[model samples]
Target: MSGTLGPAPGRIAYAELDVFAAYGSFLVQDDTARPDTSRAFITDLMNNLVATTDGAISVGTARRRILPVTLDVRTEAPEDNLDDWDHVTEAGLRITSGRLVVSTFDYRTAIPRTTVPPGDYTARTYASGFDTISDDRIHGDDAYRVILWPGPTVEPRVLKRYPHLPIPG
Candidate 1:
């Protein structure tokens, strides 16, 4: 995920990664080689995961799997909601218990520079999901305008399994 962060109400972009290892991840600031400006942090939960910025004139380019990792076409839209809000499976997967491992790399070198291991982050699920990423938060901090995009599923898996299984004699 690549984007630019502007002044107050800065955009915080994030990419959800579902990979085996954290070998390739990076962040570039101002389109220049700003050492240490890049960082990697994972959320304890899968909800509301984000990449933070300092609300400055900076550009960030991240390489990894984006959010909304999987969408159930059959159940894409929830019944409770009537606006066709897409349902994300992974979000609920870790909500109960799990962590979203994030690895941030240096944009200049495009190499894994930092690894935000499990249990170091707190992912917050937005009420509007991807659509509300840009909306300002009501409470505490509102300096950031988040933008989230669900990148193509990596190694897509079967989210829902059939209930019927014939017993083999």
Candidate 2:
């Protein structure tokens, strides 16, 4: 085994990324320090997420925007087209406790901590059709994907950025 955490079929996972009005973001953190929601969406407009630390990464979203998110765990880096997504960001995640927790800023809806071998890994988040979203029509207009693979730590990078989306302050 490459120490990858395999997908769980039928397991419902959703994180209300925009839980706090001031912080429009969700969390993908290991068993480390408490998530600093105040730090959410503060930097990296292009990437739309911030790696608070090696153990935590906050993914940005529109205010009160809730969309289905899929988590794909792979043994090695997967091939992806940067142009296919409106925005894409990559960062490193350190899982020291052998568990990864995905959740909202408020911790209201947390997918149970997933078990993985303690090690450094890479996380890439992809978003599509987000600029087309409007209040009258939200669902199905946008999509999100978070992929993880066994790898060494790396600095966050924005593979692509949507031009129309407003940059957070």
Candidate 3:
């Protein structure tokens, strides 16, 4: 019984070639992979390192702009994004409860449409806790946060919602 971040999954760690290609970026000895046992070992080693890095990329969103359309479509209520689509990662422990505040985010991605050769548009809006996330990550005496608009929906959705759990009653 094993999985990621724990005991090895299984015997004979089989892997795909693309995994090797992906980790090739971290190689120090350029063009040094010989076609033998060494190749498989190097690929797996590089992939392991790539999985540990924390770098990430995000796209920005803009204000919603209603567009004139032929087909009829109405906005529907979306579920509260308390998980993945938005990030709610915590790193440290706190000893107190804080204020609660919620914010909204809008996402729009417009490009060439498939049917409409010369027209395309996209828009979305949702509540988030970006501020809560930022505040939680702060480990300093003087803590503060500035609101950011048109940011990636997942980046700053929650700010300070979940306060520290109280002692057992």
Give the alpha carbon lDDT tens digit for every residue of 1-169 in model 1.
Answer: 2212222232223333332112212221122222233433222111122223321111111112222221111112122321332221112111112212222332434422222121211221121232233223222211111122222222211122112211110
Q: At residue 129, what lDDT does model 1 achieve?
A: 30
Flag regions of model 3 displaced more than 4 Å.
Answer: 1-58, 61-74, 88-111, 114-169
The residue pairs found clashing in candidate 1 are: 25-105, 26-105, 44-121, 47-124, 48-124, 48-125
Candidate 2 deviant stretches above 4 angstroms: 1-22, 37-41, 45-47, 106-110, 135-140, 167-169
lDDT of 3 by residue, 32-134 (tens): 1111224533333232211111111111111111211111111221223333222122111111112111111111122211111111111122112223322
Number of the predicted model whose TM-score against the real structure is largest: 2
Query: Which 10-residue span in candidate 3 carries the lowest summed lDDT?
Result: 50-59
- Full-model lDDT for every candidate: 0.22, 0.61, 0.18
Tens digits of per-residue lDDT, candidate 2, 1-169, equal 0012234332323333322223445667786536543433355532454455647877775443555566666677766557667777888888888766766643433546666778888888777766566654433356567777788778777777667664432
User: TM-scores for all candidates?
Assistant: 0.19, 0.72, 0.14
- For model 3 the local lDDT of residue 92 reads 13
Q: Residue 68 of model 2: what lDDT?
A: 52
Residue 109 in candidate 2, Cα distance off native in Å: 8.9
**Candidates sorted by TM-score, descending order?**
2, 1, 3
Give the higher-lDDT candidate: 2 or 3.
Answer: 2
Error of model 3, residue 135, in angstroms: 24
